[model samples]
Target: MLHLRVIAPEHLREQVLDVLRNEPGVGNLLFYPGVALLPEGDEITADVARECVNDVIRKLKQLDIQHEGAITLHSLETVLSTRAHHAEEAAEGDAADALVWDELIARTREDSTLTMTFLLFMILACLLAAIGVATDSSVTVVGAMVVGPEFGPLAALAVALVQRRARLARQAVAALLIGLPVAMAITGLVTLGAEAGGWITLDDVKNVHQVDFIYRVGPISLVVALLAGAAGMLSLISSKSGALVGVFISVTTVPAAGFAVVAAVLGDWSVAGRSALQLLVNLVGIVIAGVVVLVLHPRKSLIPRSVQPN
Candidate 1:
């Protein structure tokens, strides 16, 4: 279930009330007139089944409440109301099967942004991967994968494409186009610095046995990427975040990028090219898989009526 707090202008309050009254999945409605200070409107609150929230949000958007008012949603972790239970039971579809478009778009928008934290994690992951490759440690490579933030933009790209949101697609692409190269450059410099400080040697890069597969691109890599992509998308939709950790560990994106950066640092163009190919293969596989999953399970309209423009 979800809790919604809405601030609607006086003029639109009636329409909002009507919509709520007609929605079978909403309950525990409360209204307070002229309670909003910033928007100078009436405040309303309600409990809604997760399966029906997308329709409610779309209706509110159609009312243009976002321009002069505010609507916020929160998860109702523990709902004690019998009315809420009835509302959920009355909803048409299961919550897990319902695709909350607005919530998902919002989440992807936030995650796909090229933030400093995202950059730091990508670089750190690459650094760890570079070390992992040099020392031929699969465990370290897995740790690097877990720390990488590349999946956010990658997932965002898929979501945007499936939703046909051009702006979001561009943002997601920008995050990747900028983030990956930046991560590679920084990791390469770090590799050079480490070598200068005698923390690593060329011998470490050349003697890699266990981690040599990081640079070997093949059908197996594509298969792993496809499976990881599907699992990642499922984890996001199901809110099973722990499953995302497994997706991270299963893919070769971060490790491949790390290997490419280290190989470039060592001037091993052949190895660098192969690692780069592996990275590209994994990225393409994941994006294709995510798009396929989202397309297959298209978003459903919770409400039949379109939101009227105010």
Candidate 2:
């Protein structure tokens, strides 16, 4: 179940109330007229079933409440009321299968943005990966994987493509194209500096054992990426963040990029090429898998004809 707090303008208060009253999946509705100071409107709160949330939010959007006032959605971790149980039973679909499009799009857009924080995480992850490669440390590589922010844009790109949002797709692609190369270049420079400081020697790179797999592009790498991508998409839709973290650690994206950078710095063009190929394979596999997952579990409209926009 979800809790919605809506601020509705005076003119739209009656419509909002009517919509809430008529929906079987909505209960515990409360209205406070002229209570919203910033928006200068009525404050309305209701508990709605997860399956019915998208319909309610879409109806709210059609009323232009998002522009004139505000709407906030919150998940209800524990709902002990009989009304809540009835609401869930009355809802059209299962809560676990629900896909809140508005929330998903907003989250992906925010994550895909090339912010300073994003760049910092990417650079740091790549540097960590470089060090892991040099020292042949699987633990360090996993840490870099967890720190990497590349999955956001990659997931966004898949979502954009599935939604047919060209602008969002372009933004995601741009972030990937620019962010990966920048991360790699910065990692390369850091690698050179480390060698100069005698922090990493050629022998360390050549003798890497556990981390050497990062630079080896193989069929297994693609399969792992595909599996991770599917798991990542499932985690996003179901809001299982812990599963998403596992997905991050399961893939070798950051480590591959880091390996490519260090290999190039050491004039190992063959290793560098293979690492670059590994990165490419992972990116392509993840995106393709994400799109497939979204396609398989589509968001269906449940809004009433009277409430739906023309």
Candidate 3:
């Protein structure tokens, strides 16, 4: 089922509830002072039903006596009407609150010029990527990818764009800039160490030349990064959190970072530069695409409304 937020003016609430109660598609209505949730429908096939909801929301906003109620709709991932679920429900609220707090930490720029968390993430991501490349293991590569803190900035970029928070944008950009270099450097060092241990060789660097990773910066790369970015933004808006992991794998950011160090260690300057380019291209594509998708989603009122913490 789908979820909706309806806002209405104080005096017209009775009329609003009357209309909502009689609304054919609406299943269950939970009345509140200024806002309420309604089970929109079980059958949502195409654009027609969606338009109907939007139209209803628009009409209700007009009758808003005290405040023109803006209507927002979202997918309902789970439902628990029981009292135990209610206590358990607070778990999601706590987690969301924690996320908001973390966002603040990530978004806030320290006056000291560099943040410890950013630096730590960069170092950690780079080291992990280097280990993966050295081992030539996809498992390790994925670990490195997941370890890479780039996702935070990427998500932050979307949030910044949606809220028009320039400070957040700048902070995210800064994190990317500092994080990439630090990560690459750490991997470079790791690569050098792996070389000394005879784990990775110049042969591996040369092989990377023939390998077609996402960093080639062609139309396909651009398209994949764009799709990943859009999907990432959508995941954020819709609260389908599983998609976030897909976002990491969908883009070439982590792989490029790994390849950059491998190339650097083998003195394959060409490969290093190309991988760097690939990283930059993917990052730019994801950021721009994320910004655009968020802008579009909010306008369509497709973004899930963040509930106020009660």
Candidate 4:
């Protein structure tokens, strides 16, 4: 369930209340007259089932409440009331299968931002992967994959493409283009320094076989990437965040970038090229799969014809 708060202007008060009253998934509706000062409107709140969130929000948006007033959605960790339970049961689908489009867009938008923390995670993950490649450590490579932050922007890119959100698409692309190369360059320099300090011998870095799967691209790689992308997007939509950890570790994107840089530092151009290709194939497959999943998501209209936009 979600807690919905709305501030409706004087003229639209009845319209807002009517919609909430008619919505079967809404319970505990509370309206406070003239409670809003900043937006200068009446305040309305309701306990709404998660399954009906997208539909309710769409109707509210059609009313221009976002421009004239405000709308806020909050997650409810626990709903103890019988009314809330009935509301959920009355809604069209299960909360676990709900597709909250606005929430997803907001989440992906935030994650795609090119913040310092994001870059730091990318660099650290790649560095860990470089060490894994140098020592032929599959476990360390898996750890690096789990730590990689690349999936966020990749997911954002897919969402942006399907939604036709130009700004978000640009942000996601820029983050990927900038983040990956920067991480690679930093990792390359560190690899060179490690070799100089004898922390990693040339033979140790060159004799990588157990983790060669990081650079080896095959038909199965694309299949796995597609599967992971769909699962990741579905998990995001259903808020099954624990599933995302598995999605993160299933792809070889971070490991490929790390391996490519380490190989380049060792003057292994052939291996570096193959590693880069592996990275590209995984990225493209994930984006393509994510777009398809989002486009095919079940979004049957739950709004009444009267409330829906013409």
Better of 2 and 4 by lDDT: 4
User: Per-residue lDDT for 72-125 in model 3, tens only?
Assistant: 555455655443233333222222212221223333333212478767766776
How do all the candidates rank in terms of TM-score, highest first?
1, 4, 2, 3
Weakest lDDT window of 10 consecutive positions for candidate 4: 301-310
Question: Tens digit of lDDT per residue, candidate 4, span 98-143?
Answer: 7788899999999999999999999999999998987899999999
TM-score of 3: 0.59
lDDT of each: 0.88, 0.88, 0.60, 0.90
Q: 49-84 in candidate 1: lDDT tens per residue?
A: 888888899899999988979999877779999998
Encode model 2's per-residue lDDT on 233-309: one tens digit a residue: 88988889999999999888888999988988988888889988999999999999999998988454455434644
Q: Please list all clashing residue pairs in model 2, or write none if there are none.
A: none
Q: Which candidate achieves the best lDDT against the true structure?
A: 4
TM-scores, each model vs. reference: 0.92, 0.91, 0.59, 0.92
Separate clash counts for every candidate: 0, 0, 0, 0
Task: Give Cα distance to truth, residue 290, candidate 1, Å.
Answer: 1.4
**What pairs collide in candidate 3?**
none
Candidate 3 vs 4: which has more lDDT:
4
TM-score between model 1 and native: 0.92
Clashing pairs in 1: none
Clashing pairs in 4: none
